[model samples]
Target: MQQTVPPPLRPYIIHPYLRRTHTMIKKRIEDDILIVTLENGRDNSITAEFYHELKDIIQEANSKPSPKGIIFTGEGRFFSSGFNLSMFLSFKTPREIADFFSKTEEPVLLDLFMCSKPVIAALNGHTVAGGLILAMACDYRLATPNPKAKYGMSEIKIGLPLAIAQGEIVRFGVADDRNYRDLVYFGKMMDVNEARENRMVDEVVEESELIPRAKQLVSLWIDNPGRAFTPIKRLLRGPLADRIQKGIDELDWEDSLKCFFYDDVRKTLEFVQASLNK
Candidate 1:
């Protein structure tokens, strides 16, 4: 298949809101596929800056002579440790925390889920909580078969309930009702094989073969033109998308914020922070 080479992308502007120290995302175009790597030091913990950069990059990839697909992966042993816990813990008000999620995280997940081209999350390592939500937003997910690498949502254990959008993404992505309940209710981290068995990940491959397998999957869907592909995806995913959007609209942000104020959550956050510091 002859692939279309997209025109040069407009240089992305570094948003003034982004912290100057956090240039952790890197992008490279490979024959119609955009490979985006997240290497924010050790854990690639997401922050406001990470969200802005990621949103811009994905937007860029969707522009002129749009790439056939996008592959998102992380460097080192952790794909993402989820949200930047330290920063999140610092917010003083419910509104501030609500704004952070509504303004930063929500849009990015929506973009990935509703993207015109196929999006694949190539998990090189551990993926938890918000990281799992991000992976769920993708059309397909692939993970490296490392026994040490874990994947699952741990928000319940941390005294945080799933946001409406987050919950919808998981429900829509993972088809089995039993698997969905187990993941969210228990907040258990599963190994690669277990994740695959529960349909959380499409396939598990060796670290060396992760990107290649992702590219192979992208090739299968790249043939559809954007006009056709976009609408078809909308139609196919419409019911779930509508359900998710409605839930987002009805979510009680103020009440959701109260979770962070609980003693159990604070203790859990403290524990998580201490462990990360080690």
Candidate 2:
């Protein structure tokens, strides 16, 4: 079957955002929202370059004539698979791994949290581990009703502890505490319907309606673009964000770095590489 054309592109003609040519992010301004797409292909793993692109987008979003709101989504089958394992595995020492995690946790993340404009997520498909982190940074999340589409924070399975600070960023959007625990503790990927039942997904619709519905939802928030939304966002999230900051400041990322060198991690990488080849 022929693939559908990508959502229409808009020129950045005079935008202030500085972007690297190798970044996988795509940006377009649609109506009152700045639409940013994660285009890292089927897996859409987050690379250092992805962070650079995201930082540029947020900086531009904060510049003069900044967009009133933002819409973030993914292209193709999956939203994001989280950090690229190839890059993570490149480090030979615990120090290198610590550096990797530090670089991955960029200020752009904080920028997303503090942006005055409301950000919405059009969660197109499977979102796992750090993928959930990206989705959580947005103010709203819309997901497609695919039985195979799963969402979760699966960092623990890889011998790395959950980035609880980032995890809290996503959990706040959820309506129930039980649902939040299920996602963080068990680390199992949950289907679209399950995500909706737990309030992880704001709306669940047919795959065909995903983009249009996302646009519709963002449009609804445009009416009071500068007045109501931003303030409430600050008031509601400010405290939780402070805790996240504290958690990051105290985390022993060094331990995680050491864990990455174990034989199990190496074996896991080999299995993953072999499967990808297939």
Candidate 3:
């Protein structure tokens, strides 16, 4: 008997925050799994709108039980390059830039980090900066074996310190002290082998195997009896999630503003924007 695939839950995602006619996330269900793919610009840079839609999807997934699990991937060569460099340029002043970042920090990543349905990241390519945060939020991450793919957080290079959610998630994801320092302090963009060795991702698979492998892992997690995974994960991650949100609520953004407008940092941001064009 042929199984009928469920129609897409959100063919054209719309939300009040997004004033435009389009959304960057593409959603569909296959084999009862919610597959969310980032179809943003060339590098799949994270944007305010992208975060909003992703949060809405997570909320919808948690508010029901039909999809069973979720897999987040990218459309093309890059899984996500993290924050779009040009976004910073869009703001005219340090305060404006800081405010924008603050408004976007409604703990979208934390929502993913605490998703009720098991989540997996099928990283199609480069996963850096905020991209790393998104991957780290998932229960498991499988990076594609693409030569052009790179991973890790390079925010420090441009003098951006980890915000509340970014820092806590990185801390929660890894237990080794040395590894944590290497990630936040050095902030290098690592290749696939180095990424694996440094534990940026759970495993590396070929392009064809990436989505399939994510689905397989999600099945293993969701197949357990009695839906026990949710509470168990909560038991493990709840306190940290609580702490992160509390921090967000109290965040003032002044320090981050300083980092954003530091002369050297502004120069570096320009360099990043230039690099994207090249």
Candidate 4:
């Protein structure tokens, strides 16, 4: 789908607060909230570098005394197409895939989900698969009213099983068991309205309102979110995080990797991999 988060009607404030760019993330502080825009090429496919940068940003925001909430948005047509299909295709061995997933991606996702400060996804475009997984970790999500934008966890269709962090975040975020099954097992990508109904996003606003609305919502719980909100959030989600960590600790990557590489899975992945080139 052709879409772009309109050139910020209000250009990002860069003078008073820091404005910085990395390989995959564009960041600035506005109204005391961190505005993080995914800036990798067209689709903002999550790469290892992207995870590192995002994890660093989360650390920096969490370390601050006043606390900084985050608003994650997107550039161009995709909030993110999820993990880069190209990167997965480049994995020559199951060990490489296991290492890439178990070591790098999981830890970063865990950090984001367990962050003390509040986080919101002000989606500027379509979010799917692992990208939506990241969004589900946020405290709240607001998506633009982009007619073509879709949202869902598509990993099942791509022949990957949800890891601990992924499964819990999705389970914790979805409204009910049926929605969970529809998104995870069925791999059905829903339009923005359907996504809201499925609890993938909390609200849908016009494209121009995404950032402003996100900021307003953050402003409400803006003060000492790390102090007040953290405990409450932990109270609600601590067990879930612990469960995910436990699963991660005990997971047999070899077995998981083996399950993901069956003949049908490989063929499907190869087909999707080829589509990326087209």
lDDT of 4 by residue, 119-236 (tens): 9999888899989998999999999888899898888877888888888888889899888987888888899999999898999898889999998887777564235765677677
Q: What is the C-alpha lDDT profile of model 3 across 41-137, one tens digit per residue?
A: 7888877677667767777777777688999999888888888777666666666655555555445677778887789999998898888888888
Model 1: how far residue 158 lies from native, Å: 1.2
TM-score of each: 0.88, 0.83, 0.87, 0.87
Q: Could you tell which candidate, 2 or 4, scores higher by TM-score?
A: 4
Model 1 TM-score, 2 decimals: 0.88
Clashing residue pair totals per candidate (backbone < 3 A) = 0, 0, 0, 0
Q: Rate residue 138 of model 2 by lDDT.
A: 81
Model 4: residues with Cα > 4 Å off, grouped in runs = 1-22, 224-226
Better of 1 and 2 by lDDT: 1
Preferred candidate (lDDT higher): 1 or 3: 1
Q: Which ten residues in a row have the lowest lDDT in candidate 4?
A: 4-13
Q: What is the lDDT of residue 108 in candidate 1?
A: 65
- Which is the leading candidate under TM-score? 1
List clashing residue pairs in candidate 2. Answer: none
